[model samples]
Target: MRGVEHSIQLVPDYRVHHQAPYRLSILEATELKRHLEELLRLGFIKPSNSPWGAPVLFARKADGTLRLCIDYRGLNRYTVKNSYPMPRADELFDRLEDNRFFTKINLRSGYHQIRVATEDQPKTAFRSRFGHYEFTVMPFGLTNAPATFQTTMNNIFRDILEEYILVYLDDILVYSRTLEDHIRHLRDVLQRLRKHDFYAKLSKCRFAQRKVNFLEHHVSDQGLHMDDAKISAIAECPVPTSAKQLRSFLGLTSYYTNFIQGYARYSYVLTSTLLRKNPPWFWTPLCEDAFRALKKAVTCAPVLRLPDFDCPFIVTTDASDFAVGAVLSQGKGVYQFTNKYGANVDGYSPIYTPDEWSATGDTYAAGTQGLLLWAVTLGALLLGGALLIFNTSALS
Candidate 1:
């Protein structure tokens, strides 16, 4: 454990909430007993005598085993929120574009590696059929656990972070341009982990890989591509019979909103149906088209290319009856990230209709917005409106 520990800062007027443990079946009870014994043996948890009591339950793991989870919702309600920022996916990917070798390390029981502050241990108490117990180390389900863990990881890897290494909570990714450099970089990272008394799960770590998946993204020298396994739901998703199902589908696709151009325009029908006061839940023709189009577009999203500062960029744009769209491209193919990505969906002032968009004076303002968004990221941007004037010698 590091010298720094996770501390819970609860609201002053917080009320103490206690919960009873839910009954489990024979298999779950056996799993819980085994877990409790193991945790006790490792000095992670111990029998407690405290007024603050949360209940524990079992969630089935992918390997068909029960994972003991504590219902800390009551306790989380009164805890002060942590706002530590995690690394941006776009920025992280931008750094890996030039690297050839990659190593990803998965910390073993990341949260449990951090010790909870001594005075805050009782606050982590949870109830069980066997007895009341509390965590000595940081436990999952705490409101601020992610932020706390992120802060610790950031501090540990701050010097090398974004240079050739990146950490998001427990996942560590190290990137290098050459095999020789990768070895040196990997050694440095391992040494730091060793000095800090951290451990990695060998089964989960990938060393000197040409490509690896980190934070739901596939990375390599070529460009960015969405993981096929992660997006399988988009292909197999069924028509929604209820609002909940529709919401679930949208939530799933929302993560890759940046990958698809004019996503809001394409998915507007379903969103409007969900958000607006509506009649009975019915699958309209437009809703079906929107759902199918989104699934296809997201699944076939063009591989995002690394920015080429050596050449000029093209910003292709179009205006529809309801939305105005823009695409940032370089050379022949689009090569860019989304940190400065600008897509105006339901954003253009409705003063000009689709027919007047080209002829009207208001087109200047809308066009400038697109140019500025792309320009802010790259020093040079070509606002390719409806025309292109290039040297004829190149085409010949």
Candidate 2:
């Protein structure tokens, strides 16, 4: 990504590189005038006296396809960072875990679908070696381009995201196992695209596939595997140089926190101490312990199933001065192994009580007895309620 010049250097034989036909239809003279007027309103292309100013420049995609590029290089450097989250590669991968069937759709020059507002367009204008050009739609590298695209996607997927579909801007993935449901999902996505007047690069879309590449990662029914290149990058993450580095590592580790048994306790040392303005860059024993524990936790992390919110809330909790940890388990007939070191000498296991555990070596026994007392009380209440309901139903 480096060594790419900040300036636009022309290829003398621009036509050779820009040979491919634009996938979109070229504007007729009247339409061109209308577009130019639109750009004037949007402020992307201004009226300039320079003979070479604000003419469109076209370039070929790798597949010999022409893309309309507004050379906004000079202007982009001054732009402010847009407030939007780029799609997290990990989060996207995690979403496709149980998806057996998938469809991938790529937009035909995704940014071209959007028309920059009249006043905002001129700020996007840039000078190239040959001439000045401005974007009819949003351009790449603009600080706001990502935010704009994300907003566009969020609006488009407002309805579909509630179901079994996910949209990442130009990429729309529809997933299902059953053929009937899969067909319906695919139709729904395609219909939405048509309604929006968005063009897709059909050559890039995959329909009803068992596996697919999504946001640079390969996903299948088996689950997502780290991209080979990305695995090396993660492995080569440098050791913490400062608090920022420590935080970065901790943040990355936190993404997989569900897998760790006591992540809060493990991360307590670093997260608690680093907030001071002049935090020492010392790798103390506790910090090193936390660092090692997090790495181990990542490898041994449990595979948690997606929660079923309708079911009963079953929670396991343990507390310490350093941190309190809890797992909210919803499904019936779930198993949680108690830590032997934290268990009671009496061989009785507790259901939920963090404070008692810390106070007693036999917390398992103590918690279990308390749980029994609570359960008996709950059972009596439930029995009375059931009898009352039965009497009411009989009377009705």
Candidate 3:
């Protein structure tokens, strides 16, 4: 955040938007005023006379706290996007490599730690019922904020990143195989934070945990497991009354697709209706059955053991005229991949037919018979792309 200022590059002849502030309720007004005072005290923001302005509003959090936010849709339209890539969660998991100990560090007001590039600070000015103000540091909702923040974190931890530390923006996870090693790694991470003048919220930080909940997955030496809270939500969910509701359920379930075999298969009937421009609203018996089956599958999801490259992998795959399904296993399932916020969907593509994904059914096509039983070793394998590693001479 200090070494690199977040730059907000705009496209040519961008239309400057200075929208009027939205009316606030009594509670919102109180919260906004309080936040503005705090931001001013911290020197994170200042009174502005900039021509470019956006509206300020309050966004409700899950815990019901009102978060002061700016509507940046108008400004973002003209802003050039920062497409800096983030490390995938799946690749991060692979690096865990059966580490038995874990420590997670959550930074305090992560984005606020970063300064917006001097020239772009004026462009970040937003108008509120109280007054017009501009941010000195990067504020939430900017188009390039994520990329900027991610770049900052990567640069801060570049030397030790992926050795024992994995960073996703403000979340720094230091993992090690033993308590002794973990202690040293933790110190190193803390020293780095201290060196860079970054601060962590001690209350939100976990130390020497064998199991850690991160990126929506419960990560441990046993690979990634489904989060119980999310599973319970899936279990208690009422049947969907609309397409939007159903898609929400699917999105939640899809995040843990690694733990659920035949996920795409079980979810097909439920998802097919959503593909059409105008999907049928009826909750048919088949859809209900599929829904129940999916819930049951998620609740009973298995622990995806970390893949061992030394072990021989069992590549179980099947295909029908319309669909193909595959499971990468080493006795237990070992799936991989994650971005900052989402899992890779390609590995869990929707199954077109039911029986096509069945693991026990005859895997052969109705009219074909050349069954291949090639060894697929390593965690590097992709679903459709032929993947994996090991000396090919061993097969010979």
Candidate 4:
């Protein structure tokens, strides 16, 4: 109760009825009793006769222990959502450009550390075989739980947010350009947590590491990169034999679309299968080639460099009747963006008006008898083009 504050207020008019208790196995009953006893001892919950009640459920943890949870779906429907803003992952990653030292800290049972509003406590009541109970501290599965916690953390560390530390919910990342500076920053954050009586799980914390994984992506002084384990999973995935399986495959690969060049074009044929409404799934040769090409592209995806605003950027573009592709580069590092194959789609056309192309920079277009030249000269520009004219008989 050290950092507890009663701040959550549900809508005044909405009310929820009690849900009946769910049946539990003998072992599950015993486990529930044990957990309830511990919560009672800690003064986190108390016996209640509130009008509202939710069923209790047990979820298995990673360490092979059962975690007692409440079915909050009934109560959540009536609760007003909190619209507090949370930091974007991309913006957080963009701030780590020159940091050489890093430390990550995770708060212990983060949501439970906060207290529910006094008037709303009865609204969180849950039922089991023994009796009805209500939580004194905030519990998991609440609709606005994350927003509330994030607001609390932000208020606590508002002074040093972007300067020395970045917090996303319970995850605290301390970053610095030097080891000496990093130690001071870490100490400041720890002292603030101590002042608020917040505790961190030391076993889950990493201190003074040059490279650390944050927000599911690996980060270092070098730059940000996709997780190797995720890449391996994509490479090892077997060919899909059913519609459901094909959808799963596409979903997994699409997560890393930023890492792959021409991703949309490569997955175009595979996605067309999903649009068809017939019984039979047509696995054509074109689809097979696209699938194999995508897998190969992921395996050889380039390491994206962190952008430097002070340096000039190079934009290279190519357009054919089928597709359009572009690469934005600075020095030897590059990031590519491509549109799916189709000429009628907006911004996919090979021809662009001077005004349309001039937004990027100066526009330069030159043409000869049989060749068309469309170019934009960036600093130290390099332009190349190739045309492959083929006969219909050869393809047949």
Candidate 5:
């Protein structure tokens, strides 16, 4: 107990809300609050003061306990924008084609390690009753912190930038197939960080491994997978009761829209009904068809390979009463959804005679089909143009 007490004393009980006498009511919340109070009393935890009277951000002490933190959202609004180059998701995934191993590393207390430039340190001020305390290290909720940190890291690893690497704030990923290759990559990463005086907490980092989760995607020898958590979220979706609910469902599916073929047509009917004010919720045969079509699309989704700029693109497109969509798919198996949009289609049937086809229907169908075809042709031409540009420059 004495040793435990001494360890607690070393952990600072900083003020909360930028002031001393940090008060927390253990009585009102009872269960959870009591847990916090007990930890504080045992010296296992302390208050974390924020510079700008915002909420404090808490970190797990060497001892397992919760600490109070202030919110710093207010001060971060005024920071300068960070002009860092962020990696595109598809671009990052493309590099993993040959690799069967993956590893994810997260920095422990990432922002806390870096000192905010002394002049800018004063800007992170927060008000509290006891007194104001400023952040000795970079505080959370800063607008520019992410970009700044990312840029700093990029510079540190610039020498080996061509290798497989992705950095998002404190998270760094290294990918390779062989154990030996991964070890070499990890060594290079660590050595560069050392050269730049950037330290990482090993406890929070996972070194080269067969599979890892990054940005919620499960990456492994099998390739990238939709996160189970995301699947669960989709599963929890309530059945559509109105056009609004249906639209929300469509939006969710659209987040993984690339995985599905003809996604726009699949979601067309449901999306159409939602655009009108006070629209009645009608799950007609068309709506049911669209809904089932979307679900089926996911189940049969193709495994697309990565795109190579040198390869030719096989562009495809389709249209429906309400929407037009196109995919810029490459033969190597990789594809990207270049365009999708809702059309102001009134209604149209091409099979109908000139007299039978209503003005509204023809206009809608024509616009939808025209747009879809146009998108595909344009996408193909763009890819060809890009190839030409690159080759011409290379030769020159």
Candidate 6:
């Protein structure tokens, strides 16, 4: 089948050599052979005698099938990164505000639908026990593959982007304010994809629906909500026994930092454990308190409402001896932020002095009332006057 032509660009004076084939188990060997046979039959790849080769790796899919993948990490190091911009998740979510009807399309093996430029195909060659093969079509795990696919999608749907269509990599979201309009939008997107010979997996596609999960957030006419699965994972996480485990827990919770009020304060004790050097891992009473507080907070996270640009915002802040926190609200929805607990410099006594609180409150109040509260800077008096920056819109 005809596919979109994509080229891989390398930095000047960078060259890669062949990597020896990785040892595979008997099952892996059988899987690799099956994959090679299928790809050969489909003409997606062919026998190659290229100077550059990479070892193959197998990733198990949800269906218990192994996916053949080439380890391109070494090759990627020599490649120049494509600077093509991708649409921001926030901006994409914002476009679905008033959208009632939605359709999500998942392109089938999206990267494989694009052909590697002739001269660059050799650089993508990989070795297997059977022989060496190079991809005629673009393969997964390539550095520039995402940029190439995004560029193709953008070009294909240039006229409808941000209107009735939102394309992010291989996921295509077709949204409209009305059912009739939504159908038309979906038709237009499918027709465009057909024209370019791009195919979407029907099973994975969600037809006109009132609600859909996109970019890890549940989006609908009601507004954006944190995914329940993610929240459940956080709530069910066990107490960390080691610093590494604590770091992993922190990383997971930090993802929903915007959803949690005083996230920094809640995580302060656990974070401090990570900062300590040459010490045994110990879960203190403070750490235990923080962990439980975080779990409770995530389970009760507020459902955020879509921002209304027409309305004025309300900004509120509170400071304590341990930490400083702030909340930005519009309508009934609010986003919160806070500083670390016991964050002091030179062993300072107070975290935030009364005068500092007043000054900070005045700044926030003035900025919000004037609709110029683009950014807020809170000084940590204890940490030798370290500044904590918060973007007003980020909370929303």
Whose TM-score is greatest here? 3
Report the lDDT tens digits of candidate 3 across residue range 1-396.
467788888899998899988999999999999999999999999999999999988888756899888899998999988889988877777678669999989999999888888999999999998899999999999988889888888887889988999999888899999899999999988988888878999998989999998777888886778788899989988998888898889888877776675676667777666545796688889989989999998897766666565555444444433334445555333333222123232332121111223233444433222223322222234233434322211111
Maximum-lDDT candidate: 3
Q: Which ten residues in a row have the lowest lDDT in candidate 6?
A: 347-356
Tell me the spans in candidate 5 whose CA falls farther than 4 Å from its real position: 1-52, 55-73, 83-85, 126-133, 197-206, 220-223, 240-252, 266-301, 308-311, 330-396
Mark the 10 consecutive residues where model 5 has the least summed lDDT. Answer: 1-10
Candidate 6 — which residues are off by over 4 angstroms? Answer: 1-3, 25-27, 59-67, 242-244, 275-280, 318-326, 332-396
lDDT of each: 0.73, 0.53, 0.74, 0.70, 0.53, 0.72
Per-prediction backbone clash count: 0, 10, 4, 0, 18, 2
What lDDT is reached at residue 128 by model 6? Answer: 87
Model 1, 50-166: lDDT tens per residue? 899998898876467778899999999999998888777666665675689999999999999999999999999999889999999999999999998888888888889889899
Give the CA lDDT, 0 to 100, for residue 217 in model 5.
67
**What tens-digit string does per-residue lDDT give for candidate 5 at 1-396?**
011100001114333223333343453234345544554474333453434355333444436565545455444443344556676665566566567656677876666556665544545554334344455456556666666666666766666654767776777888887888888888877776666556677776777777677765666655556666666656667668876677777776766665565665665556656546887666788877777777665554444443455655444444444444444444342222322242211221110000011123444335544554455454452345543210000010
- Our model 5 lands, by Cα RMSD against the true structure, at 11.7
- Please give, for residues 70-153, the per-residue lDDT of candidate 2 as tens digits: 444444444455566766543454355345888888988776567666445545455433334455466666556667776777
**Model 1: residue 109 alpha-carbon error in angstroms:** 1.0
Ranking by TM-score: 3, 1, 6, 4, 5, 2
Quote each prediction's TM-score: 0.81, 0.53, 0.82, 0.72, 0.61, 0.78
Please give the TM-score that candidate 4 achieves against the real structure: 0.72
Candidate 3: list runs displaced more than 4 Å: 23-25, 320-322, 332-396
Which stretches of model 4 miss by more than 4 angstroms?
A: 1-6, 21-38, 57-69, 129-131, 232-252, 275-299, 316-328, 332-396
Q: Candidate 4 lDDT, tens digit per residue, 1-396?
A: 365564556678876768899999898899999989988998889999999899998998746888888999888887889899999765676577678898989989888788888888998899999899998888998888888889889988999997978899899999999999999999999999999988899987999998877776667876767778778878888887777888778787776665666666676667755545754887788878888888887787655555454544444444432333444345433333232232122221111111112112223322221112332422122222322121111010
Candidate 1 residue 100 C-alpha distance from true site, Å: 0.8
User: lDDT (0-100) at residue 385 of candidate 2?
Assistant: 27
